[model samples]
Target: MAFLVVSRYSPLFAILFVASLAGLHCESPGKSPAFSFRFERFEKNRSLDAVIALYGDAEISDFVVGITRPAVFSSGRVVYRKPVRFLGRNPSFSTYFAFSVSSPDGGEGLAFFLAPSSSPVKESTNGLHFGLPPGATAVKFETRTEPETGSHIRVEVGGEISKQSSNLSNVSLVLHGGEKVHSWVDYDGDSKRFEVRLSKSSDSRPLSPLVSYPIDLSRVLQREEKLVGISSSSGNSTQTSSVYSWSFAVKRGAPYSMHSEPLDPRPFVVRARESPPIHLRRTYPWGVFVAMVFAAACGGLLTFFVMFVWFALIARRPVAPVEYPVHPVEVGYQQIELVAGEKGVDSTKK
Candidate 1:
């Protein structure tokens, strides 16, 4: 009886062992490689793995290290030490971060940027440059007012600070209010669309984004590796920019080349084979395309109008009445025979 029981239970034990092994294999890290991190809070003593305080007044306090200490004319930056790796030709990513800005007076504000690995942290000059390096793409939340555009959220690329595509109402969000604001930044590499959504920390993700634009980042980043970071500048005013939480994740897939043409790792200025910078290339093409489209439309309408008028005139032309010639008929006199007969009758009657 004991031997029979052992044989029957052995098969059940073997099945359970196989199932456990399969579960372990499925959970292995080698099958899926993804870059992701979430930091809800920060401690001064906690060592951040693969995180770097690149430069300037950036330190860990009660929050993550991107927060700048309250000081006038100061700036801070924090970046992930490892460069972002793309597993496919078109890699996508979504990031969410919460920040608050408090200032007694006006503030310069904060920014999130993506740049090439070789870029250096730029210092503020006359409260301008928000620590964004050249060839970087950034979304800036500005608290200070400008002569033309007041406090607004702007998305810029390739170091060109042009007015970005955004809803006008986004200006109502007070950047210096010191209230925690949540921001979501998403990029779809296949569609080349970049979007930004903003809301209060208490609320969930907004249904609509504050700004959305189309951009090909491969042209800007120039390589597979890129540095992602946050920066804030007091800019002649006393300000405190605090980041409470941050999360970032990249989609996983099979690896592929980023661009059709391989790019040289040298600086753009030194690359003789490369084309002109992105700002110059992106700005003119849209204007030229719009102008060409408008001109074609006008020409087509004008040609159509002229052809319609010509046809109408031809159809309504006055036709003259046709005239026929009246030919003359000659009458021959038959007087000789009648005269002879009448002469003979008149001589008899006389």
Candidate 2:
């Protein structure tokens, strides 16, 4: 690792040297760019474990030492469902997602990384460095308002930037939370070349690779087990972004088509969402149902009140006794006895 760096930046200088040692080919950044499938193409189960932060909260919601806000020392990560397939010969893997960032002065920026899985996602002391985990390879996307520096891309391998190989130039595109920009990272197993592309639209890939490096994965990856995901950070500078969608895959058959595009980009068509980050759809119905129940309860109370008032009014009046007429065809026995007593012993004689 120490001997790989012998000089200053030159076109494909570091890449050539590195690839030679590893026995791989890295394409130049100026070459024709193409490749990668959209994330929407995958099913829901593709996710292994996700540790990204949403709404200023982290994927691990119950933790005390996790990131909870933007523009702070924060980073987010999403581990693939399984170790990316590698034959230990030549391997190809890709991750694509659209991100939007907003910062006033300068933000530390976002990073794409691969690291070992621990009990919990590691948090860096500073956001500018993306709380870089040990043995991690990361590519950072800095915003124009980074507190310490201007906007640019910085690549870190093994927790340190290879000054001789890293690019420290400003990108022309303006990034914010409103408008999303598409980014693609593709590692060609055939060439052992890694390339990245960024664009404003998913209908098209970037015209050319933003940065290209020749890395032989079979050498760097010790075991077949590893993690692939993204992270971002900000110190004093405030920033915002979202991982709206993402996808990853391992090849077993043929080399992927160098030129393949989706028939329908569907920029206007909103696909049936599998789920939303924060769901209010169900809450809407619950609210309506609760209100209806409350209304019915009030109506019942009103009816009871009206009936009570009617009873009070009725109580103020006196109720008259009802009389029944009776026929005296058969004289009351008491009356007959009274007559007999009046007439003396007449009843006894009868």
Candidate 3:
């Protein structure tokens, strides 16, 4: 009886075996164009800026990108357009952003990154811990471990002095894959502080910051310009995640709006803000040996602009209103009888 049953179902078992082998054949990560990863702007539906995506092994039938597109069986990355003032020579600056990441059954996890624009993305690697490629600085949220998946912050420059710290309290880094998590990364150069925070509400104050990092913006920002983005990777189990929305803003007076800073729209500048005031480094002529003399002459374009602005802001006194005097009018008809003496004399003489 058992032999008869085995022989009857032999074809079904063979078909299932063939399908499993095919999945393994296409399971190569970071390679193969047929299973290639996608990085692109998410323009339709809910107004998000970008995305990185991949489908399950041999599961590429209906891959979607924008809001309406299902984020099923996808693993991808996305970055913002513009670069803000990360660091500088003299004056320092700070920036803050708000973003949301959603993953139902966490795979590799999400990452927030600040990468130099010059580096190309093709050379990057993928995994839960190393969400970003090698050429950038990143803070990754790892959700694939046993006890408690950890979130880490890291910076790597020219493959030297690379370090990552998970010293943050796990409570602060709490996240769930299916539900949306609201996160914020703040880099305040003025305070010399770097921190990450998450919240349930958009308007809520940062809940005990997940982690705090003390970074010297000047050193971390090797390049003057950098891009803000996110990345994630999954295991063979197959996973998908999406960046719901992202807003990049530089702190101005009274906090700026989401669009306060846009990825540099110009291809060449790439998220660069307005250029800084010009600096003239040329030396003085032989006739003027003193440094002050050279500095006075160096006030070419920038110095003039500063002076113009100063004068323009000065308030001018209001002019006095003009006054016109008003006079009374009198009208009367003169009688001709009183003036007849001269006229009568002329008539009588005639």
Candidate 4:
């Protein structure tokens, strides 16, 4: 009966083995391609400028380069230009190219803006290059020296600079030491607004919100126009600066709607999708497998021995006899009736 029971359930082991193989066959979905760019050097002397033509209709310009002189004395200078068109029908946007720079003296810094003309401007005296024209919404992140504030970093939105804190304030976002920082401005079509955010690779913190403003696409210039590139400068004090890389992405028509309604979308499939089966041909190493098998067998044998000993102890216990012994006194007190019977027989005989 035990053998029949074991045989009846043996197929379940095969089913579990097949289920494990099936689990490994499922694969993850694909992902979109990442867009990026890197620039080794950008200098007015080098005449290097990076440009991104947006869907062939608009252009985003970036100026990146090193400066020999600082912004204080006006020895170092950088400039960039590209043709752009804002037809007043499509949304056009611009930002100072984001880059990482290390200065020997840490004197002056960088800027981003859209100029009436394509020519590059000199580094401002009070870090004013970041401020945009009147009625223009712009944000600037600057790190420099101040008379009352000393050395600090900040973000300027619409020419208003927020107080500096170790935490990410309104302008400059805190980046983890030893990691790159990235920030961007995005136009959302569904919301019909522009949103700005900053991100750091080393920090796991949530994106820092700069600001959200309405997009007035009609304000942008029409016909062919030039887009400005990223620029940086040092003060009169000698210092070397460099920009590693920068890039931009633009969508022509209305901004794509990224929002989606929540749905399970799982039970609607009718056909069972087939996939290439995973093949697991390799087994444990011969020596280790043999050792494991031997150890398991020894463990099972030990258990059997323990059970046999327990059953033997229960079966061999001595049991008491049912009858009791008669006392010597009772035996000695036996009646003399036997003798009386004999005497009667003798008198009859006499």
- The TM-score measured for candidate 1 stands at 0.58
List model 1 lDDT by residue over 1-350, tens digit each. 44454465557545655654565444232322257655555444325533655567777764345556676777877777778875556667767778888876887888898877777764543334665666677889887755465556788877786445343335457677787778778777777777777776556566566776777664454364778888888877888887766666666432222222322212211122223221111134555666566557556655655665565557566678999999999986543322347447332221
Can you list the residue pairs that collide in candidate 2?
48-81, 101-176, 105-145, 106-145, 106-146, 106-147, 107-145, 107-146, 124-131
Please identify which of the two predictions, 2 or 4, would achieve the higher lDDT against the true structure.
Answer: 2
Give a tens-digit lDDT track for model 4, residues 1-350. 44453465447544644654564452222211112122322222222323321110111223333433333433222323344443335543423133443444444544443334433233243323432333222334344534454323443333554323233433444331213445444554334565544454333223434555564434433323434334344444333333334433333433323223221212111223332111112234664666566557556655655665565566566677899887766444433333347446332221
lDDT of 2: 0.50
Model 4 RMSD, rounded to 1 decimal: 25.6
User: What lDDT score belongs to each candidate, Candidate 1 first?
Assistant: 0.63, 0.50, 0.43, 0.38
lDDT of 2 by residue, 70-114 (tens): 545555544443344354366566666666566554555566776
Compared with the true structure, model 2 gives a TM-score of 0.53
Give the Cα-based TM-score of candidate 4 against the true structure. 0.40
C-alpha lDDT of candidate 4 relative to the true structure: 0.38
lDDT of 3 by residue, 7-29 (tens): 66556545645654564444222
Best by lDDT: 1
